[model samples]
Target: MSIVDKVRELCGTKKITIAELERSLGLGAGTVSRWDTRIPGIDKVQKVADYFQVSTDYLLGRTETPYYALTEKDEPSIQADLERLIEDLDGLKYSKETEEFSEETKELLIASLEQAVRIAKMEAKRKYTPKKYRGES
Candidate 1:
C-alpha cells in the first residue's frame, strides 16, 4: 500500500478525517494525501510519525510495525540521560592539573567513553525492540 493509504488507514482507525489530521498538523489541505505523487520533506514526515507514535521507516513502508515498543524513557528523556552520561564521563573531575595528559589516562578515558556508549546502545535496543524481534534489528 502507498504511504497515503497507510495514513488513510490510520485516520480511519483513529476516527479522524484527513482534514482533521491536516488541521492538527498545521499542514495545508491535501498535504498528506499528496504522498501518492511525492514524498514529503523530512520535517513533515517526522510530524506524521510523531503524531501516530510510529517510525518514519514504517511510514515509508520499510517496516511492518507502526512503531517501536515504548521504553521507560521516551526520545526526549533518553537524550537528556545521554547528555548527563556524557557530562559524567568528561566532566571537570577527569581534568588533570597539567595541560598534557599521559597516554594511559587517554586510553582509560577513551575506554570509559566507549563502554558507556555501548551500554547506552544496548539498553536502548532492549527497551525499544519488540520482545519477539529481540536482537534482529
Candidate 2:
C-alpha cells in the first residue's frame, strides 16, 4: 500500500486523529491532512516516521516489516500491557534521581533511561490491538 494508505489505515485503526498526529508531531493540521491526501515532503515525512518510530522507507511502504507497526486498536492494548508490566515491575518505586556522579555513570544512567523508554514503547506496541476495548461495556 502507499504511505498515505498505510497511514490512513494505521490511524483509522488506532483511532488516532489527524489533529492528534499534527499536535504530536508539532505540525500544522493541514500538514498531516496533506500527508493523508498525498505523500508529504521529506521533513514532514521524517516527522511522522519519528513519531511512529518507523523509518521513512517504511512509512513510504518501501519496507515490508514496518519498524513501527501498530494500528489504532493496537495502541491501547499496547498501552495497557505496558502499564501492567510497569506496574508489575513496580515502576513507581523510584523516581529519576539526579545524583552527583562521574560523567561516565551519568551517561550510563541516561542510556539506561533511554533504553527503558524504548522498551516500554515496544512492549506497548507488541500488546496493541486495533479492535476491542480494554474494559468497555
What are the RMSDs of all candidates, in order?
13.7, 14.8
For model 2, what is the C-alpha lDDT against the true structure? 0.61
TM-score of every model versus the real structure:
0.50, 0.43
Model 2: residues with Cα > 4 Å off, grouped in runs: 36-39, 68-137
Candidate 2 at residue 74, lDDT?
Answer: 53
Residues 19-133 of candidate 2: C-alpha lDDT, one tens digit per residue: 7877887887677556656657899877776566556676676676554344475557555665555456443444368344566764565566555655666566545623232
Give stretches of model 1 more than 4 Å off. 69-137
lDDT of 1 by residue, 35-129 (tens): 88997888887787667766777778887755454445455655566667657655444355645656787678666765665567556654566
What's model 2's lDDT at 42?
A: 91
- Mark the 10 consecutive residues where model 1 has the least summed lDDT: 128-137
lDDT of model 1 at position 101: 59
C-alpha lDDT of all candidate models, in order: 0.70, 0.61
Q: Could you tell me which residue pairs clash in candidate 2?
A: 13-72, 13-73, 14-72, 73-129, 73-130, 74-128, 74-129, 74-130, 78-124, 78-128
